[model samples]
Target: MKDIARVSLPGLHKSSGGFKSARQVLIIDGRGHLLGRLAAIVAKQVLLGRKVVVVRCEGINISGNFYRNKLKYLAFLRKRMNTNPSRGPYHFRAPSRIFWRTVRGMLPHKTKRGQAALERLKVFDGIPPPYDKRKRMVVPAALKIVRLKPTRKFAFLGRLAHEVGWKYQAVTATLEEKRKEKAKIHYNKKKIIVKLRKQAEKNVESKISKYTDVLKQYGILV
Candidate 1:
């Protein structure tokens, strides 16, 4: 039952010698071209109410000319009025926040319920070993290797996963679409169970309290 509420952790736990729950932290390592893919995976987990932590973000793959890409990004930002119009020599570009924030938009967090789950995400540039340096971990190969473009839909979906702190796991050698859909179903099922359990607990508590109060009034100490 505790597993239902599990959130992802970025690295190994020292004293516990494992995760606080079976659920773990998501970690990705890549550069440039692969960065978007990795981010997509992370964002997926975040949407499922998991806590996520990213590592070695700068090393992720990038497929294009770095300078040219930066220029294009800056131009886009300029057109969007991302900076003060009066300011000169100022430009906006990709940073971890930009990358992660983009993924957040993919989520349905505008809803009150989603906003409640949005508090679990965390992003970092390098391994944040909880116990020791040796304890640092990486995402399973099954979680990585998903390739999504920068299209609007992809960006939206990827950001939703990011906000939830999902990890990339491409190690199973399964088709990308299948693995993602499976993960999504698993996440949704777990969420439903957790919600139902909370409601059940509340109902049980209410019954018990009501009975106990009645007994007390009748001089029964149960």
Candidate 2:
């Protein structure tokens, strides 16, 4: 070969002092996306050393008859050896956690490198603040609306999460609390803005009043 093309990563580089690695922080919106496809993409991105944050995990879709898929998951959760309960695989009931487990299955999690890659992944049931306003990318290939066939029924992870023992009420309460906090913050800022504007207007009126008083000496009466 005449030459090897030099390939450099965006946030990963080697230095004389230490091994430096920096990767892209990718934020993905999981709403209305297919679980397997989304998980595969997330796994690939994390393995590339990029940080992946998946939001709205509860809204992710799984293709199949709703009840069938539900029962299938329930059966899988029951897998355990009587003698080695501690050694059996653990499953998560929360929608966010279930989504995380799906992603984990796509990775070679038994190895050290796979575990490290998994550390870069984050999944949330809903859009959390700080990420709520950020630009979130959607996986086109995994979108249910775009790819759904009218004939095949579908199921949402949100419903499955509830059936699997996730506390839906608690999630709702927390989300409501967060919304209230954000609303309060916004109201406070608006109040401060209105106060400042009124103060400025008063200052201008006072200056005009002073100017009018000066005009009194010139025989200009209001």
Can you write out model 1's per-residue Cα lDDT over 1-222, one digit (the tens) per residue? 132223234343423322345545544433332555455555566665556655444334444445555554545555633365655533312234555664566667788755644565655433344421322344432222334345412122222223333243231113345544765797899899999999997879866987888888999865
Tens digit of lDDT per residue, candidate 2, span 85-155?
78878878888899899999999999998999899899987777778766678777778887888787899
TM-score (all chains, Cα) for each model: 0.43, 0.68
Candidate 1's TM-score: 0.43
> Number of the top candidate by lDDT?
2
Q: How well does candidate 2 score on lDDT at residue 70?
A: 89
The parts of candidate 2 lying over 4 Å away from their true place are 1-23, 173-222
- Candidate 1's C-alpha runs over 4 A off are 1-23, 30-33, 80-94, 128-222
The residue pairs that clash in candidate 2, if any, are 11-22
Q: Count the backbone clashes (under 3 Å) in each candidate.
A: 41, 1
